[model samples]
Target: MPAPRLVPDLVPDLVLDLALTVRHDGKGGIADDLDGVDGLARWVAARGDELAEAGAPLGDFVADEDALTAVRALRQAVRTLFARAVRPAPPSPADAQRLLPGAEALDRLAAAAARVPVAPRLTWPESAAPEITYVPTASGPPADLLLAALARAATLFLASDDRTRLRACHAPRCVRYFLKEHPRQEWCKPSCGNRARVARHHDRHRVESAL
Candidate 1:
């Protein structure tokens, strides 16, 4: 069975989770996931508030030493994020590297993402998807394959021939991504839509008065 995608910003959150490599707590014990291999739990720890805000949570669940070390490093970096944000500083190379790890499964997902060629047509057949496409082998699709498939679809939609249909928010401050409801729709929400309408009215009024 395809592993269910965790509902809370899983793509972004999973990226964070993957960056975390769990290890020992230092007293001496194996981690839940990464053994003593030195993994990304620190990154997850650092994003505590972010996860909290996202209705998810980041916890220090590692029991292994190597994983604990990496998690500590990530926590330190995350701690400085807000302070660093005050300046126009760019992310450090190490921080950028955390977004993708060297895992083969992740590499396969990346390759799949690159090859995604489907258009963003939301047509669903009677069967949403087979509960299982095929039996899982060690080399078969990654556990979170449904999300991987969706991620691939999203990539394809962005790269699609009908690129104009993919819209970024018209309101500069709003950072949400959305698809255009109509060919002319620019704002992502009705509130932003209403704001735009008012702004246009003022511009028109000013032009007429100036004439």
Candidate 2:
């Protein structure tokens, strides 16, 4: 039997969930269609992907085929920004604008996401000391604020002993995040495991037939 996926009590889990919501097209790659991938992961990954590629960090992205190069560049930037949970502070306003022109929406969000706390610091770092650590009295805080808050909260709450394990699903087409199971669970689940097994089987059969 497959083990259950690890889902820590992230006050507001964003990056992991958001990145997982991609769907596979008939071809072997991600598709933007939200039909199949709509769920918790979808919601978060959508926000992430929005900021990452569509230039809608504050949830104001508009979909248009206006420019291919610009769109691809935006996505690459997003990926680079969120690759590390503990990234450097958001760029200065001037730098943000320089990195993504006319993308004030995402620039603002990137600044916010970059603020998420990632360390188990006892006292606020001199840098973070100036920042107001806003804890939400209400749930479902704005995505940007939620991400920042979660980062700070986690930093405060976690211990050096309290481990934060990151796992990527083994599925080739899926870049989803999952918590590490209790000494088990290599793939995300039986479904993904079976699908991968079948894919390997078909390839092996084809190769044998050719032989």
- TM-score: which candidate is best? 2
lDDT of 2: 0.39
lDDT of each: 0.37, 0.39
Would you estimate the TM-scores of all the predictions? 0.32, 0.42
lDDT, candidate 1, 44-72, per-residue tens: 45655643332232342443554344334
Over 4 Å off, model 1: 1-153, 159-164, 209-211
Backbone clash pairs for candidate 2 read 18-44, 18-45, 117-151
The lowest-lDDT stretch of 10 consecutive residues in candidate 1 is 132-141
Which lDDT value does model 1 have at 149? 38
